[model samples]
Target chain A: MPASASSIPDTVLVSADALHALAVRVLLRLGLSQAHAEAMARTIVAGQRDDCQSHGVYRLLTCAQTVRSGKVELQAEPVVAPTRGAVVRVDARRGFSPLAFERGLPALVEAARTQGLAALAIHQCFHFSALWPEIEALTAHGLAALALTPSHAWVAPAGGHRPVFGTNPIAFGWPRPGPYPFVFDFATSAIARGDLELHRRAGTPLPAGCGVDAQGRPSTDPLAVAQGAMLAFGGHKGSALAAMVELMAGALIGDWTSQESLEFDAGAQAAPCHGELVLAFDPARLAGGDPAAGQQSAERLFQAITDQGARLPSQRRYAARERSLQRGIAVPRALYEEIEALGG
Target chain B: MPASASSIPDTVLVSADALHALAVRVLLRLGLSQAHAEAMARTIVAGQRDDCQSHGVYRLLTCAQTVRSGKVELQAEPVVAPTRGAVVRVDARRGFSPLAFERGLPALVEAARTQGLAALAIHQCFHFSALWPEIEALTAHGLAALALTPSHAWVAPAGGHRPVFGTNPIAFGWPRPGPYPFVFDFATSAIARGDLELHRRAGTPLPAGCGVDAQGRPSTDPLAVAQGAMLAFGGHKGSALAAMVELMAGALIGDWTSQESLEFDAGAQAAPCHGELVLAFDPARLAGGDPAAGQQSAERLFQAITDQGARLPSQRRYAARERSLQRGIAVPRALYEEIEALGG
Candidate 1:
């Protein structure tokens, strides 16, 4: 193990490097190839570095279980098709999505850089991360990016009584000449599935607008809504957007919809095997003028937002990232121990 | 001036062709060239044909006033830039967007067909129509499309009190092997600006989530919110989307942001002169497989939605379109007379 900070009974502070190396070791022991282990570890460490604990090291439990059950293609290599204009296709070969995205980002970035716009379609993969990481990666290349994917059938369309859509998420990133780019990743559903699970684990009532009971009636019980259907945010409009995600990421790519993905999950222990769509736009190409002027123009809008007392969407996450960089991430002692013991 | 169904005290029926011609005549009388008048008329006819009263002939009232103020470049022609890779641009020359969109569609369709994906950015335009017409037009060509544009500054961001964003609208279309495509066009705001005006005229209270007063307190008064701030739909998520529109359509295209557009409006009578962004994706190029097979796969998801007894968005509009085809459109006599008297 690498260096770590002093620990307490309930919380353990670990350096980002140590946390990443530990995650890689655990994944390697659990059956992932070294290449995939490194890729997955980078993603998990990013979640913790940003203080998004739900997607942090806590995910190793599912990874271990899913692999043990022979659900994941532990050694499968992702394949990228030769670029066809502005659309790039990546076949994940029934493995996880992170490695595939990593392999294909170069092609996507190249296409967008030259063509002004490009879309990447990743198929036959179990997507395990929020889209922000992919969006951020594109933003790092000074590209504006939009990403979407459908998960297991856990959310109901607005006005429907059963789950037909996933906790489909849409994420966007706009490049800026600042410390961090403007980014937002959110599920079209009223609440994210991970958040719902945390609420249920704590035996807490859900906030209003979160969900409907099994009978399609409003309910505060996290367990009930978890077993029932998650409502789309903003009612019908959000539902329409969720459906758009299903079509764009799923049908448009000739992959499984959320319903089909859930059916494939069978026992439901594994993450949903699905598809993702990512579109990146280069401001310089689109502006048809000076890219610097475009960036300056965009800054005015951001300044206007902050000046009026409204916080930008990812300010909290960015602040947490700053803090985590200074002091290591603190994790629950019990959860940390569990992750440490995953290889046992 | 033209043949009409015998007028009743409250309503008069007009054939779609007749209605289109009337709209053309009215716009022509207001100084629009014949080509521009015809372009604008088709959009107005489509709205009434779909039973969307808010966007129908009533829009002529605003069009007349706007043109009379010399705010519209009535004879200005749209110029479509030769395709630059997968991006196409149309300079509206300060005219209404309808004629510009008409002139640009062919180039956009060709680019999307050859490149798998394409984006059409229309700049320096006064957009005065709902986006569905543009979306549906693309769907008619067997393509999936999405369009968005910003309007006058009238909406508040989710956490902010003052209005900074527009009633930005997003529209999407998916092609299917059926009479009507899967389509949805909606404002990011809780309620559309036209609907608010209707509520105020009828002296009805605004919907619960519609708006806030000048002090940022929630209010049901249409007039107060109109003078104050209209809320974004779905809270923070919708607000973020609205902001995205501002960047993609405004700054990304090097056009006016909503705030700048409002400042240009000065006394607030002209339609927002900004930019529009439309993205078209070719199912065939992106699928890299059998196009018909992909369409078949998409139909399964649509079937699942209807199987759950949940109505898909735009079903009512399609139904109304069918009715209008058979029985013609019924326009309230008073409003019809108002439109007629404008030409006189």
Candidate 2:
């Protein structure tokens, strides 16, 4: 792989196909269906290709453990039902989120095209994968999309000392008349939980306003924050956004809130079972019935932003994907060995 | 009047009705139709009732100045046209936004109720009022709503030196089966331009991360920030949100981006003529024709938030509204006098 600035000498470089095969093998061994396993593997490969290591093969071990522990059903078949008007619902049957999304997204997109807008409410799934893939899929089909989900609580509300919110994430994608769509996905917290975990492992200090210690005092020490609560990214504004996600993904979907998810986990090693809300909009219909006008508007917006020298969101991920395709994906030797052990 | 903690002897108290009458009179004197003037007055009154003084009567002086300067059209009628399927468009006819909204919102709500979701794109209007009032109106009709709008440039990109974004506010409202809907409206900037102006007038230092100095260094001096650029609320994440708003409200609505708005204004004292995009979702359709279930989910979400002692968004505004009803809206004597001068 083209070496990352932080890559060590002991890192293992594997072709993208090899990494996908490895993930599929391990998931199949855990009793996943052939189609389900392959879908899961593709998402893992996308994560690795995009340089989101936390959501890549590093999550395979937990997936195996969760399936073995019966927290995530191995052969569950998600059921998709058309709700009133253009809304659809997916009962994940406690399976992985990828399978549920696979079954629901096509219908959602069709509904949006027919009705101008549509919504998908997915529940009873473990959504540990990156959100960008799903939104990107919608944009690739010439549709605009927004997705929100609440995870287990790791963030504290503004002025609060305890964890009451998740690293609740919101993702949006807009289809333009170009090869790449405008996509952005981010957690509402100051940093992702995995990033904080890395800082703790390396014994590094975090930036100011990242988190608070057990006594609610601002702290740069990652270990202290791990033992306490992480702060929302932008004080009250971030807190408001986190709460909004909770309401949209949790309550609106009739699924567990972040606090409820924590209780459901009950100290388990598996990822939390969460809900996801995805919205798709057909800009062709919204742009006075002219699809070209909608695409032109999006192109104009991209030009305006780029002219200001502002980096488009997810631009780095696309760059990383190109490098990984040219060379390979770099993984720590230890992690690769660990995955190999799980496969057998 | 129930006194606010920050209220001083220089504050003048007026009944909400009287304030509304005064605003209507001032707009009518500036050549607005009676209906348009009354609609505009109601929005201004709502801002003061909700304790948002920055968007209340304090803006009347500038409103008059802009109208008298022939920037904001005084007697324009908005046109609402159904584009395709559930989407609708409003040509604001270069008039006030309140009139456009007044004419278009009912049709937008009806379209959403029929199609499960609808979008309203408003253009060629100057939008200067608080967004909460509009979104709250949607929730009042049992519809979930989201609104985004761009303004004059005052915020810089994450690492860029000069401003390329406006405050770029976002507002959301979730309908619940309760006395009030869950609502939130906030600027993507660390602090709003009006709030920064207040700090500058008071000769006070701003909080950390609020803005950058002319040299692109973080500064606590409000004066320096006023002369420089405001920072996005949470670095890159906030910057992405501001850009998203600009795309949706500016390019999508065929209006001006923040930079373009500045160029159009040409250093005028009047408010920038911006665009707005409002989305309405009918939960009755999304909840599988069972609106009660949607309401119940919202109620459960609110309960969970309140159980954690996390303040619900807009709770403060509701409390302020109650207090204003019991007593009166507190306005600075100078602002009241300035508005009175506009009436003559």
State the lDDT at B38 in candidate 2.
89
True contacts kept of each: 0.62, 0.30
State the DockQ, from 0 to 1, for candidate 2. 0.41
Can you write out model 2's per-residue Cα lDDT over A66-177, one digit (the tens) per residue? 7766688878888998655667789998889998998998899898888777889898788868899999899898888889999888788886767878899999888876
> Quick one: best lDDT, which candidate?
1
Identify the leading candidate in terms of DockQ.
Answer: 1
Compose the digit string of candidate 2's lDDT tens values, residues B281-312. Answer: 87666554455655665566566557767778
DockQ of all predictions against the true structure, Cα-based: 0.71, 0.41
RMSD of 1: 1.9
Interface RMSD of 2: 3.0
**Candidate 1 segments exceeding 4 Å error:** A1-9, B1-9
Q: What does candidate 2 score on TM?
A: 0.92
